[model samples]
Target: MTEAPSPAPVRIRPEIAALPPYRQGKQAGADAFKLSSNENPFDPLPSVIEAMRSATAVNRYPDASASRLRARLAARFGVGIDGVHVAAGSVSILQQLALATAGAGDELMYAWRSFEAYPGLAAVAGATAVPVPLAADGTHDLDTMARRVTDRTRLILVCSPNNPTGPIVRQDDFEAFLARVPADVLVVLDEAYAEFVTDPAAVDGARVLADGHQNVVVLRTFSKAYGLAGLRIGYGVGHPRILDAARATGIPLSVTAQAEEAALASLDAEDELIARVAVITDCRDRLAAGLRAGGWNVPDAQGNFVWLATGEQTLEVAPRFEDAGLVVRPFAGDGVRISVGEEASMPAILEAAASALSLLPEGHPARAM
Candidate 1:
């Protein structure tokens, strides 16, 4: 028999070991209401499910390029086919971008605590991470971010309608921010929650790209808005040459034929799917208003969820939420982020928020400064 390797002999990369693992949603039991992970609560579209069922070509590998999905996306975005490349998910695409572009003494800049993966991806790719702090309003401090940029900075990430902090960077501000930054550095506008936004001035990465900016690449996924969290499909669009470069590096990484079929069907049902998003937008607004009424530090969110800027207060009150059968997302020391799903998680969540207000320690900041 082949000998089993000793644990000590496995000289793994220290950077990998030093990394804090990504925290997923908490699981209570079979009947728990999980609002922890920001996934859409709806079932997959009938069209999407049917596509998956018909895609039984499990005998073969997926197309490395994911051409059909790309074509569909191009039509939707009104971009050339060469401008899009689909991958396992936007998070996967982000990691690959960090590897392919930013590395070896280069610096990767992004808002602090925006996406946990930013630093991990930077470390794995042998790059320096410079985390710019968010504004007191819990939005990207674009001016400060622009000031923090240096020649060594190889990549800049802008998360519109930022996760955990629901502020959308205004388009005019981003255009100015884009103007200030050096073009050599690849700027990634992560629009994972793009479909949920209803703000008039919100920075739309697609519109920005269509404006003919060369180095700006936009990342989006089917996980959130499309209700396809299980599929792990995402794409990026940019200058054809730049996107093509990212594509060339993304070979051998894609979903099965089943995933492709489902994605195609999802595209066909976009109008219906978007109508579903309208409901989520409503929920987001109602919850934000409700949280404010209960005396929590809730922001004016534009995405599918509202965030509690309660800081340490969240830690103290998180258990109360658990007791109410609502699983909320708490970032240990930073704050709490809750995903607004259906009417079910709301009553329990609101009750928990009320309890949280009373249970929290004195002198905790009640709202964002």
Candidate 2:
């Protein structure tokens, strides 16, 4: 007998139903290096771990407002307590901001090949995602982004040291871009990897906010530099009214007590964490330099990762690195992004990069002249 036809699936928003879930970096085996995710390679400080241990009151719900952590961040950023909003991660803030600012028929704009989550976030919010292509050098084409702004546009996301591509939005350029944007449209500067940026000219979100750009909100995370990826603590610094709107859209009590405790401890140990960031930045620079020396057109890598523009060969080239025990994030038909991992992983990374370079034609865009 033939099986009965399956019942119609429960109604999900068509966009949500069609949307792909966020893809995480591929994990590696015990002996292999897992550099797919741009994670801090260092172990948490003893103080941070101790702080987490002290937060043993899991039976009780955490502070729904995450007041202490918000207070700390506010003081650090020299903002009023209400000016800071803490959440599970900076991505959560992005979601909240999208919900707060845009809705069905509204448009949310950002640079293409950025954060990867931007399109999904806009779709989830029932907003249209307007992605402007990156410039040839893998940086945001801010001028094009400004020109594309429509009256329906409600929110914009700017990811600096843009994910996968590894180039930053410069300060002067960012300021000029801001000037062209209408004052009513909200701009969210997603700076998840800010700590890894060593360039003197990269846009500093703190400085931008201090300059009183009311339309701007700077989102940062403890995930990258502080080794708190698992805890998921991140925050946004902006005008209180804007943050309040985002907070209203957020899920209450999502930031756990352990995460708050750990974040506070991480801040207390800032000097040590900054030093670790320096090491990773140095490793990133060396790795990029090595790739360039081998004739690969590596971009100005300001984050804890470097990009290899393997183009149509991305799928084929990624396996070469995997075979070399390096798990990297490959954007099919685009390129590969290998996070700057431990110093010990450098040799294998460089070797894999060199092999990938060999697959390119003599004068491909990914090759240096």
Candidate 3:
């Protein structure tokens, strides 16, 4: 029998057609530790679980506005209810803000090697992505970033404790950078891993917002610290007008009732949740110390992950981790990111990292003195 011919591809935006889909971290098998995604290894508190279980009314659409959750967040952040906006996740809010602020020919600026989603968010809004390379130490060079801002720039994303590479932007540096940015241009401080930060000098988005930076919006998530990754809930705090614009661009009812309930429960259990974060941070510090002791030049890991700047050896070293019952995130030609998992996983992680360090040349950048 003759084979049928394939149908013609449907028309779509060429830029989008050329864009690569967001790649999730690799999954691990039964015997392996999944340290690819920077997920909280702690189990959800019983209160949060109960809250989710109580949200049994699946027959009804969620509050389109996510009012109660917004109110709770507003109170916590000392902002008016309108100043807070809830969404399926902080990334969803990012896309909404991009759509609200920029379009074709406009520019959305971010530090490259930060969040992997920033460029895709810009592309989805039909805006050009302006990725400023990170400094030699893997932190955002805010001075250089501020200098790069142009008239066409409509949105700037600042990721603290930046993903993959983990150093944070200092508060003083962020303030200086903000001063240089045009007031009309929106700045979204993506603080997805804010709760994990232990540095006293790291930029505090809430403090910035409270200081009357009306052009700035703070994006945070329940996914990381709260162990609500499966629930898909997060919020943005900013001027009411700015949040309103984001709301205009958002999909109505995207934040589900269960997610809102779970978020509320997490907030109620903030003390307990924060205790868990301390444990994770301790684990993170130990992991970083272990990697550095192995002669690997690990960055200042403020997030729950350590970066191995494997450079060209990223692809080659990733499987070595997999063979040792660990799954990690690897950026080809750049580096590998290993999340701080259970304390028990640390021995294997350190062992794998030490073995991988031997593959680098004598004077590689990822090697420490």
Candidate 4:
């Protein structure tokens, strides 16, 4: 008798396969300058490195609770220990949030062309992802987003200084948006680049949530401000009960000892970090100006990066940058997003933008054609 073929082991969820992979720009070549991921170009503060070195104890497991780091974060944010929960990174905390709240029948809502992580997390939790389009100005259309929140929507993600767009939601507008959203719907304000924001109207989610709002949570990362990207430390602050539930669902021992030490030291060096952020913001503005001078439709950047709103696939322009020894992020169908990593990369970025524009049609952002 013919042997029966073994059945294929079923994948965890169909949605996992359906979701597109997060595309990253190439950096394999020796001459390549990778600016794809939004990582700090500057080395970690000397004090931060030394602190991590002092805490490197390989044989022992990390503090499962990350109590000291969490406590420090709580003090820094002026929140209680119960309100703050530290994790491997802010992305990790976001993963836990999706797993804990969204499931097979639920939906996770966020802006399209935002952080690519959200849809992946939602898929892993067997949930549907609802992506709303941004306004013509590339800002979240809050009115439309509020309408998208149905009974099946369990989580709403707001990325202020929104990735790629770099615009913050005005405080009054956000409060009005919050007022319209149902209390049961969890609203996550991702302020990863909050430190760089100079906009007076930027919504301080901490203030809103701390004022007794149970539905809102604020996510911040040490990777951006403290220059601890490799160490991977980030946190979420919200209602104590909400954090408690999230804590119960999180992966144990996510924060390492070295990260804990670096985070604490970085907090101690807040003033210095803030100054560095200002430099980066200046760089971002400089980049935006340079692009505009070249006739690119560059948007106002409120973060450590500038965005070139080509409103086309980034892959089309990526090769031009690659040829010039720089690797910048390219979205498949949207526009190119470039991070202002260092003072040195500015010239290269401008050259690449000029080259790429030459290849596109008229009225293109770069006018290279």
Q: Could you say which candidate leads in lDDT?
A: 2
lDDT tens digits by residue: candidate 1, 10-38: 78777776776888878656666788889
Kindly provide the TM-score of model 2 when superposed on the true structure, using C-alpha atoms.
0.97
Superposed Cα deviation of residue 249, candidate 4 (Å): 1.9
Worst 10 residues of 4 by lDDT: 360-369
TM-score of each: 0.94, 0.97, 0.97, 0.93
CA lDDT of 111 in candidate 3? 95
Stretches of candidate 1 exceeding 4 Å from the true structure = 1-8, 251-253, 367-369
Counting clashing residue pairs in each candidate, in order, gives 1, 0, 0, 4
Which portions of model 4 show Cα errors greater than 4 Å?
1-10, 20-25, 28-30, 364-369
lDDT of each: 0.83, 0.93, 0.93, 0.82
Show where candidate 2 strays beyond 4 Å.
1-8
Instruction: Give one digit per residue, the lDDT tens place, for model 2 in 1-369.
Output: 999655447887889878878889998999999999999999999999999999998999999989998998898889999999999999999999999999999999999888889999899999999999999899999999999999999999999989989999999999999999999899999999999999999999999998989999999999999999999989999999999999999999999999999999999999999999999999999999998998899999998999988899899899999999999999998899999898999999888888888888888899998
- Superposing every Cα of model 4 onto the true structure, what RMSD results? 4.0
Global CA lDDT computed for model 1: 0.83
Off by over 4 Å in 3: 1-8
Clashing pairs in 4: 296-365, 357-368, 358-368, 358-369
